[model samples]
Target chain A: MTRNETVDVLIIGSGASGAAVAWSLAETRMNILCLEQGDWTRPTDFPANGRDWEARRYGDFAISPNERARVTDYPVNDADSPMKVANFNGVGGGTIFYTAHFPRLHPSDFRVRSLDGVASDWPIDYWALEPFFAENDRMMGVSGLAGDPGVPARDPPMPPIPLGRTGAAYARAMNRLGWHWWPSDTTVATTEYDGRAACINLGHCTPGCAQGAKASTDITYWPRALRAGVKLRPRCRVREITLNEHGMAAGAIYYDADGAECFQPAEMVILAANGIGTPRLLLNSASARCPDGLANSSGLVGRNLMLHPWPQVSGYVAETVDGGRGPMTSLWSKQFYETDPARDFVRGYTLQFARGAGPVAEAVDSLAAGRLPWGEGHHRAFRALLDHRLRIGIACEDLPEAHNRVTLDPELTDSDGIPAPKIDYRIGENTRRMMAHGIARATEIMEAAGATQIGVSPTLNSPGHLLGTARMGTDPEHSVVNPWGRCHDVRNLFIVDGSIWVTSGGVNPTSTIQALALYIADRIKQRLATLFDPG
Target chain B: METSQDSGLSALEIDALRRLAGVLIPPDAALAMPGADDPDILADLLATLGRDQARVQAALGALLAAGFAAAAPAEAETLARSRMATAGPEAGTLGRVILQCYYRDPRVLRALGQDPRPPFPGGHVLEQGDWSLLDPVRARTPFWRDDRAGAA
Candidate 1:
């Protein structure tokens, strides 16, 4: 294979964590290279630019890589998993399809073991990462109201997204029931922040934001990192991370866009591939020196997988809520976000309120739900739910379980002959109980909001929050990565992604994922003197 | 069960689709909303068949084989309901495509009080709601537990 010139730092995956760390380390003047498997996404090429925008969600912009099946996407064997793997392989990664409903993990989230006594506590607490959360928020241009009593008080860079008619309806319901509800901390800019424009109240925030308002890393950090002199080479699919005689990560071998095999050497390697991608790479890079995996001395590299179980409850209100006029989630409730001893479950869920879908989606989904008939009553049923429906999506916290893991498929391989990652996951009893409670609560709220008819999607299979496959902890014997995100076995290797999470919080993980990346970058800078010293 | 060369749909199949579409969603004179088999909507649906050609063809063939075209309007409706109850892959595809195309029509969108154009450059305006609704939530004390409040 071809050998490229060595760099000081080699990073893989240019999505949320990758982009943040690259930007953080750029000021050091060290040669930093990020190899991305997918090409850049142009805003004009987003689905919103076409009349068939809603339709494209099921096609090109599908959250599942198996369904999208782009050349850059590697097939995932999720047959054994009730919750399918949802991810994007492009420059922005899953952020490209995220709804931008950003919320930080509560302080209690880091102390799951201490508080609820379920999952292991994070090596680093929420206080350790609080500053990084603020820093990443500035870079990503967060929009939210301050003093949300659920978490700590902090001002966002921009005003909170407007609580339109739909949000107002839900807010009134919460007030009637005396439940806590707050405007969601969304990453979409309310006013023009940085160089991006403000959102125009477009119906669908996923399928890529044509408005340039949503903070996908491609439009958020990647541009700033590029300007800071971070070298990014796209369309280079990494096959394996190579190790030197000393068993340190020497570099990575990847296939370029032309399908030519080449090795990009570096002094240090950082993995920013998400939970599944990161573990898949580690397992595929196994060698005689480390037969199980590169950092498998603990045998925890691909263990403790957690995919948050999200259940959606929706119903039709009496009046027009104008559901197709704005971002999906403008408000959420932390009413059941913490532990309650009386409840059967340990950790709770966040109720994220969403506006209704557009005409096509509304018609299709309503028909399936039996709310809209297929005969003469179709028009009346469709008219009732066209713009009057509202939904509450419960983001249930998933405790880490060793059996719910990502393992290399024995037979399935990508086009490049790399073994695909197979997921074996089932909703645990705790999550099932949580979902039941959450559904009941959501139905109650909808009824209080004066919804005439209600529908429940008990479980959403594609939650897109892939986390905890390579957990971080203080103990090297139980975790794949140490507190500062360094592989316990590989001295010069580090990981900065959702894969390092110890527990899945009830809110969206993008905010915490970026904070962890920024925090790890700071730690790496601080320990530059003895960065490669053996543990 | 026949297939045309260009549109991947036979003339007979297109007629069958019209009959099936009417049974799927009939015209409503009260609201002036056209059915899925409206001439314009049927034309658009047929024109857009290339988007998901193989699946749509299979679905149409299945419906036609089930004698939906040969049956009376009431009998066709009964047959459609039974097929829908089963929700087989072919029935699902047919239902989804018809509804998707039906909702895209300007008349349908207008009747639903939505702008006919795509949600882009001409995005709609949403008036902000009462921010005082959050007063109660904001008045409450912080509920998050502090894990390291007294730590050095």
Candidate 2:
């Protein structure tokens, strides 16, 4: 296992996209080598208790303590940097810690520019990606309700999870207001669809799932790829993409398990290292042939970063709703998902009614709202409120802007001497207006649902669903990747992650990311001789 | 007991944190004993408890200040109760206080009769039936040194 092995295909970063690509290519008999930066650990390793889980899951040491020191670290601030780093490393990547809400983007989302003058339209339309989306949903075993008038109908592979009290209350409120809402489409299996157990509604999907219900890529696709003879090397951090004299990607240089430098040569390379890491890697791989960075022909290797903005509005009800009993978000409303002329903002928002909170999260919420920390006053308040709170989250679509971008800081570097991702972002006027509308609507819904008193936090920026750092387009001068996720500079170098998204849809991007990976793998398979053959 | 001077904490900051923690947990006055004089010792206790003591203190102080502002003629405790009641049970002021107490107070632990060696309840516990109850160990055994290297 020296640096001499030659593989047919080398994939960097074994997250949702990488895992899907590996699984799809495993059947092609290609010698595929997938590299993951974090160590491979199972769901059984997660802590059951709240306090320990909080420390292990939310702490900076979420990854292996050694590898954790090397990754990009950003501190949180209330004013400027409100983005909390909710990302995870390892085989499954962020999927292991996500809330598992898997909603596909509507057809209109692809034509945002045509519908409104806010954002640019994606080069590939919904019709081109519809089949791949279906395939991805089927492969992931999505549990959801079909025939909701508010959204496009796609027959789910499994039935939706049973609606709990929180869901019921939200549904009633929606019905009262005549708003469009439905059971959220999630990756959790409902009836043991694909050798995985169904969700038991543990309400702790933020950390790793203990019940194996959350369909993390490691559990769903990576295992299948391994069984099909794909070689997966966990704890392998890719440093740079080495190019040949002909200006094509030759192989990747990475740090092995023992922190030793190793290089693996391949005919073709795929970078699925997410929106943030993909751009960082590309920018860091500066060389003589590519002066600005690898695939920096357009000077757009790391630009136009987009994240779905989320602000929460919560309330208290009279009934005992055990808020911490089920999956984090089981129901969502798309009544305002599509853009309207009445609103000032070009993009719309989705209202998600989900389970309340864990004990720790609830405490944090109370503290944020200005409450006394302890004593008889604290005891009386806790007893009065423990079982009656109903929480709702509003997720607003943030349209991609040229100014909000990710660039490498010349000064700051990680422990491994890699440049830190310098994010120059501010909440645009359109997004702020959309958030205000969403918060007001959410507050009205809560009040109508017999809520005694409701509390709404001011607008906050969301760190989840990072997208569009290297946007896809038909032209090479304006975009980093083509419509098929192939780099314009290097034909064999493909990127399939949120980085390729042209617009941030008003929904979770995981399903779309997997669909894009599937589409790209299919393209590679069809053009195997032209792309991968060693003449 | 280390006083504020001994602990190197400003009297205002320590007093604020102590009052906030007391409000969060509202200890039974009968059971409430005089806290250690050393603010440093109290600060160490809070740090050992592993909770966000500063944020709790700041939030509690803001709430009290707001309540006092709203009802000038009303008692401080009554105003605090009214403000707490507005949050309701799941997210009410009292529940948050109890959570803070559970995190920052050794007195709460002593009342529960738990060992303070590991500090937390589920750390390194082997007999726990639930596999999820155990703390995450990075590498249980090295692959080269393990018995099931070939089997794995």
Candidate 3:
């Protein structure tokens, strides 16, 4: 078919980064449109608690990209990678079911090569992105105390959500160990603000949030961006980026919801389709000028994939740690966040305490551990999992390595006849050593906190936090995008998602990901002079 | 027993699955909830997880043939433990489906001190809890090391 409609800018994926950019650019009176592969999930869809709500988590709301398996989604063959790609496809993307854990990247994280000496240094430092972090915090309405001395100091808009019994127990343990522990800088609102209702401490933040307390972009950025005038076309899966004679991104060819082909032309194209998704689109867009893929000048479009390997350890605390109550995880320690050469690990990890899963989930955990017996002692076996359990997740920072990557699978394709992403990754030696140290440290903490019958789980099948496929760098010969998120080969094309990450920090990437999008959007607004220049 | 329009279990398989549920969920003091073999729960399990009769028959048949249903509680527990020890993911998935069906019941939630209905619309009124526990961590300085990703 002919071109559907022409706009000043066209964005793909309406997730954290996409929403940030869309909201930022909507003000310039430019014709902006975002094409999403999935439909919008209404808040009403996720009730606080229903009979089958917990069951539905393993169903439609399942975090596994393969398990949720929406029509717009393609199965990721992650045979080699320890964790599968676990994200959603809809308007808010994975944020729809995320914990809304918001944390800033440290200044050391940006200059890792200069400071830590392992990973590549980001072209832009934490100071350059600090203002955007604060901006995002204000926009998302973060909840926590501002004086966290871990990074630079900044106050959150809302007060810290109550630590609860579980978090408090862990804090005491951290204090006993003389370690650094703090309330998480979460995106969940404590009191009602910005039209959304207050979080009622409902533990089911993952399946979905009924109260708009969680700062998923659909409820935060979409509403504002829509009001500010950005055309949103959902269920439109972009197939490839079509280029003009001058090798600039002219538009994209996509398959509409009806399985019909459509083309939307634009002066510029922004790809916020995430780490896995951004590369999937790039690899699929093969043409004459770029025989390998569109903007794959360096053949690094899908290289250096990073999924923070999280090893969760749990034990029975002396006091009740709140069985399936409050938010998922509100307390965390960054004591091991910095790399210690004495520890034999290149980079370090973080230990965050979580109130264990719901009743059904606990039962499953018990069974998986082979601790829950058949007839008698079932209750006794289950008490540690349900009530007095304090769970800690060891999140290790994964370094970028060429061998660990996402590539196109020739044997498998999605429902839309597009090649699916196949992952080939393994945790490097640095990460493994870090994980072992973290687990040992975690075990010690659990023991010190008067916990009994402590159980440390094997490495989770999937790490879940997928990042760094289309990594950014200063040189065009090595990275897919530049530090500014602009494709070095295709000036008119930009990728503002986690794909542009130079290094994966030891914490969650959502907060940093969204901030980078805002930073890039401002750059595009200011650099309008040579945006469409043929030079 | 409440029977939905869709229960893909055969009469023989249902009988076998029903018998095995008793061993899976035994009535105890703390767990005042219904047993897995309870008629309503059995029907619910059959209606939901019994979609693939072949798979259900295979797993349940293995347990029954090993005298898991008719044996004493102690003996049945032994058989189940042995079977589970030898069984693969199919057995794990089978047990998960059974436990999932058993726990979804309202009686189970009441026994666990939780409201029976879904958690939204009217949510839990949990306490802000004691803050003294956090005083120690709050009193100390942040522990992030000045070093970035240390040199390779």
Candidate 3, superposed: residue stretches over 4 Å from native: A532-535, B2-5, B29-31, B50-79, B132-152
> For each candidate, what's the DockQ?
0.74, 0.07, 0.52
Model 1 spans with C-alpha error above 4 angstroms: B1-3, B10-13, B49-51, B150-152
| Residues A276-372 of candidate 1: C-alpha lDDT, one tens digit per residue | 9999999999999889988989898888888898988989998999677899877888889999999998989999999999988887778777788
**Could you tell me the TM-score of candidate 1?**
0.96
Ranking by lDDT: 1, 3, 2
- If you assessed candidate 1 against the hidden native complex, which CAPRI class would it receive? medium
lDDT of 2 by residue, B1-152 (tens): 43555434445645644543344344454544223322433555344332334444444455646654344433544555555556443224333433533533445334333232221222221111121211121112211111112533
Model 2 Cα interface RMS deviation (Å): 17.9
- Report the lDDT of model 2 for residue A90: 79
A-chain TM-score of every model = 0.99, 0.94, 0.98
- Fnat of each prediction? 0.83, 0.11, 0.60
Poorest 10 consecutive residues of model 2 chain A by lDDT?
A70-79
Q: What would you estimate as the lDDT of candidate 1?
A: 0.88
Task: Write the residue-wise lDDT of candidate 3 on A146-189 in tens digits.
Answer: 65656567889998878777777777787788777778888888
Q: Pick the candidate with the highest DockQ.
A: 1
By TM-score, who's the top model here? 1
Which residue pairs come into collision in candidate 1?
A: none
Instruction: Select the stronger candidate by TM-score from 1 and 3.
Output: 1
Residue-by-residue lDDT tens digits, candidate 2, A246-272 = 888989988776877889999889999
The TM-score ranking, best first, is 1, 3, 2
